[model samples]
Target: MFCYQCEQTAGGHGCTKMGVCGKQPETSDLQDLLIYLSKAISMYAWRAAELGFRKEEIDRYVVEALFTTVTNVNFDSERIVNFIKKGYNILAEARALYEKAASDQGRQPHKIEVIDSWNPPQTYEEMLAESQGIGIAARLSQLGDDVTGLQELITYGLKGMAAYADHAAILGISDPEVYKFIHEALNFLTADEGRDADALTAMALKVGEVNLRVMEMLDEANTGTYGHPEPTVVRVTPKKGKAILVSGHDLKDLAILLEQTKDKGINIYTHGEMLPCLAYPELKKYPHLAGNYGGAWQDQKKEFDEFPGAILMTTNCIQKPAETYKARIFTTGLVAWPGVTHIADKDFTPVIEAALAEEGFTEDAPEKTITIGFGRNAVMSVAPTVIDAVKAGKIRHFFLVGGCDGAKSGRNYYTEFAQKVPDDCVILTLACGKYRFNKLEFGDIGGIPRLLDIGQCNDAYSAIKIAGALAEAFDCGVNDLPLSIILSWYEQKAVCILLTLLHLGIKNMKLGPTLPAFVSPAVLNVLVENFNIAPIKTADEDLAEILG
Candidate 1:
């Protein structure tokens, strides 16, 4: 198993024997095969699009298939094999679509040796063997490290884009532009041509450009389906009774579960990225919706085990379930584990039964609360006050300090950075990384809370909108504004978000708890020279550098 598409890749290099995320060699290799299948589908799908022929199901299948390979999303090899089998059927349909288009054009179809002319294997062992030819090391040998690294960067960015696009599709939102770019990008990776570093880098930024649109579509989906998030105080403590904890980034899954368990005496609590769901008017209307239960995904081992009710992981950020709570934890959507119960049909009756069986919180815990839901609408509503504060020099700077959190050692830098932020500045945070400092009091500038929680990672669109609005008000480009982006990335989603920022020509951002192992030194230099992007140093050192 050679994988290094995440920030926590082993020893700052590829993971060979097993993923640091606890993914086995077979599972990892099968995921590679699944990716190969998705790329094969895209090769035909891209041409079909060019020929003015497209199918929504084919587009959605490729998106979900790519999403399934994202870090920590799927660990069940059997489930992955099922996806691979399904992919072959879709690939045939894609091929036939291309043929129809080609026939219309009165020309023979174009072919690629490995992708278009290849036959998918029938069995699991054959699939594993198939992954070997297309694996990372094999590609690195075929193409040099720099080119392959850039290609992987684009691939990982596409995975992130697929995740957000899938989320938007669930909310009944779809865009052909997003689908077109995804297919084109994947096809570019599938073909042997255009593997030069400069070409690959340009494609990576284009992935960023499309990712921005996907994020915007997702923002619209969330705010339109559920009313725009309002500034509301959420309980961070547990309520006494039967409970079900919903972790991960899927708000739709949380809403469905809340409806199913509302009158059944199960109190639903959000964990990890789901913490922002409490602010949505449509979701927050549930009477039995309890409160947040835990921190980021990396701490789930201790937190999930201690929780006394059923736990449902709606999307990614799943860990190896501890034996103490293994039977009670369930996986749904694209998330899976080898032996964990999976809710494929969205009927969470099994989850409710398990919750009722367990002794949920013996009694009410001490009450604690935090304010969330400072999304674009919530923040822009008070734009006048924020603008006045900035003009009057009441707010010194704005710091965007959050991303996907992890179990890495240097992550405390975020907590310390937030703690050390000046009293006059505002911190706009999102995703699970907010757990590092959301619990602490950052006070407020006039009526504005100093720490603004801008929904989940996908809600990055909200943050971008907020910044653009602020920049417009100030009559300056975003880079000229007195704002600093301090981001921490753990997985592929973070990779795409960073790319989006760079695509916008946003500069001088600090990214850490470590750079991705997949980024070569030459590529790093290019980013640094062009965008002024740099890895984070100590909290104090970075603070001094930014403030001074």
Candidate 2:
């Protein structure tokens, strides 16, 4: 097994034996094989699209398949093997379209031997045997590290884009061109033909360009479906009732669960990235949608153990379930745990029943609160006030210290950084990283809270828009504004966002807990030269550099 698509790759290099995130070597190999076949599917679609044959559903499926392999997402080797089989089936259909398009165009299609003429074995064991021949080692050796790294870079960026796009599509929103580029990009990585490093690098940036669009689509889907987020103080304390804890980033699932569990004498509590749901008008309206329960995804084993009810993970960022509550752990929407019950078709009947059967908080927990819901609409509504404060020197700087949170020890840089921000500065945080300092009181700059919770990592579009607005108001470039972006990355979603920042030419931003192992030194040089991106240092040192 070889994987290096995440921040915590082993020893700043690829994971050769097992994932640092507890993914077994078998699961890692299966994920590698899944991507290999998914590439085949994309290759066919790319050729077919050139001849005017296209399938939006196929394009969407490619993204979903890749996203499932993201770190700490799917640990169940059986499910991954099943997903690979599904990929081969999809590739079969895609190849037929490619062949037909070629015939109609009076051209013989290029015969890609492995993908074009391959047949799946009869059993899972045979599938694994076949997968061994096409895994990352075979592919990476052919391209070499620099070229392979660039391809993986582009592929991983697309994976992140697909994850965001999938979320938007769930809300019945999508963009055709985004899907088109996803297929085109995935196809670019499949064959040795036209795989120039510079061209691949350019395509990686293009993935960033499309990712901006995907994030915009997700922002629209989220706010449109749930109503614009408004400032709300969520109780950290749990109320007495039968309880269900909902984690991950799927608001649609949360919405459905809320509706199904309403007045059924069950209380729904947001966990980790789901914490921002409390700000959405439509979701928080249900009286049973109780307060947030945990800090971040990493704490779930402990937190879920303590929580006296069923836990539902609606999207990514799920850890492997412990045996203590493994039976009560439920997954949906691309998340899978080996022994956990999965809620397919958005049905929460089992989850609701589990909550009813378990003991909830026997009485209300101690009273505590955290303010969230400072999304674009809410933050931008007070734009004039913010601008005025900036001008008057009351708000001296803005810090966007956000991204995916992880278990890495160096991740404490974000906590120290956020804690050390000046009183006159405003900290804008999103995703699970904010769990580090979100509950701490930063006080307020006039009527504005000094700390702004800008929804999920999905709400990055909102942060970008707000930054553009701030730059416009100040009559300066985004990089020239008194803003410092310190991003903490864990997975592919953060990769796409970093590329987006580089695409915008937003220079001198800091990224940590560590640079990705997949980014070869050559690629890192390009980023450093072009965008001046830097790995974060100690909080005091980095803070001094930024403030200076």
Candidate 3:
């Protein structure tokens, strides 16, 4: 398959035989074809936009198709093949719109190149044949790693923006600028005329800027739809009842599931990234909305096997299902597996029935609980006290240590780093990566919890807001504050968030367990020389260096 878009590429280079994420060769090839076609749609959409023709639907599809290709999102070959066919249809429509717009302006439409031209295949076999010539390996043959890496960096960042923008769009929040950038970035990647490293790198930074807008849109959509998050304790034990465990990042799916399952005698529990959903006032209002069931997506194979209930995945971050519990698992909204039932149109009837038929927890698992929901609103609400605490010497330093969680051995650094922080310092975290140390009791600094759980990875917006607030209060730049950022990234979403931090000119950030395989040495050097981005060292050594 030759995929290296994620952190855990095989042997730190590429996954050639099969995806480490359990994506089969056929599925991987189909995903590549889908991306290739989506770029064609983007090329047409960009030209159409110049002719005063624009379609938000096409713009959204561009983002979504790219997002579907992200790691651990979709694995069903049939589903991915269907997405490619659908991309062909979208591209055709976009091309017609572009041609019409050009005719209206009395100018001839630009000629379509072979790479950007596609026709729908009649069968999956034909689709696979078409994919061989359109994969990343072919693109790399024409461009070196440095140029290709920068292009992929921009493309992956756009994918992350699309994922966040899709979530916000569900809640009826969006920006035209974000959509315009999507079309522009896609066309840039699809162009046959090669771009130099400096130009590609410049476009990548622009992706970061647009990603900032995308994240802001999502922040507003989430807070507006579900109310600003507040600190609350969530039960870790599975309640005794027929239960439904919901995972992934789609709050809309969770809301609908809660509504459908309410008063039906089924208890709803959050799993993985869905754990933060419990803090939303709108979602938490359900009396039967029980508690969280798992730590992070990486641990789900074991966790899902152990949970005696139906599990629903509403977004990405799905693993290859285990045979024992595969039947009880359901997918929706771009997440797919071969054997699992999929809930489309927000209809979770299959999941509900599976939960009722299965044997749920006969007894509560334990009385353990964890605290979350220190979002921007919650933290800012206590801003005065925080400022006073910092001024009074009760809070000496701040560390934002969080990102995606993976199964790599070096991941223990995050847990160790969190554990080593002094009592006087506050460790703020968000995303699944926080699971590393979230269960460890860090106690509170006076009245403030030492380990502040911001929302999900998308809630990096909250961390940014909190850091900006702190900087404004202290009358210093964010880099000048007594705060350090320690991030561990797994996928493209983390790429966008890291880019957003860079867009804000935040420097000296530490990223680990390893740098992205797509980041060539030249690209890495650019990041280091400009932003001072550093790979992590041992936890003890990093702790000593940051404190020093």
Per-model C-alpha RMSD: 1.0, 1.6, 1.4
lDDT of 1 by residue, 366-470 (tens): 999999999999999999899999999999999999998999799999999999999999999999989999999989888789999998898999999999999
Worst 10 residues of 3 by lDDT: 113-122
Tell me the spans in candidate 2 whose CA falls farther than 4 Å from its real position.
102-110, 193-195
Between candidates 2 and 3, which one is better according to lDDT? 3
TM-score of each: 0.99, 0.96, 0.98
Best by lDDT: 1
Clashes in each model (backbone N, CA, C under 3 Å)?
0, 0, 0
Predicted candidate 2 versus true structure: per-residue lDDT over 257-354, tens digit per residue:
99888779988999999999999999999998889998999899999999999999998888878888998889998988788888778888999888
Each candidate's lDDT (Cα)?
Answer: 0.92, 0.86, 0.88
Report the CA-based lDDT of candidate 1 relative to the real structure: 0.92
Runs of candidate 1 exceeding 4 Å displacement: none
Model 2 lDDT-worst window of ten: 186-195
Superposition error at 221 for model 3 (Å): 1.3
* Preferred candidate (TM-score higher): 1 or 2: 1
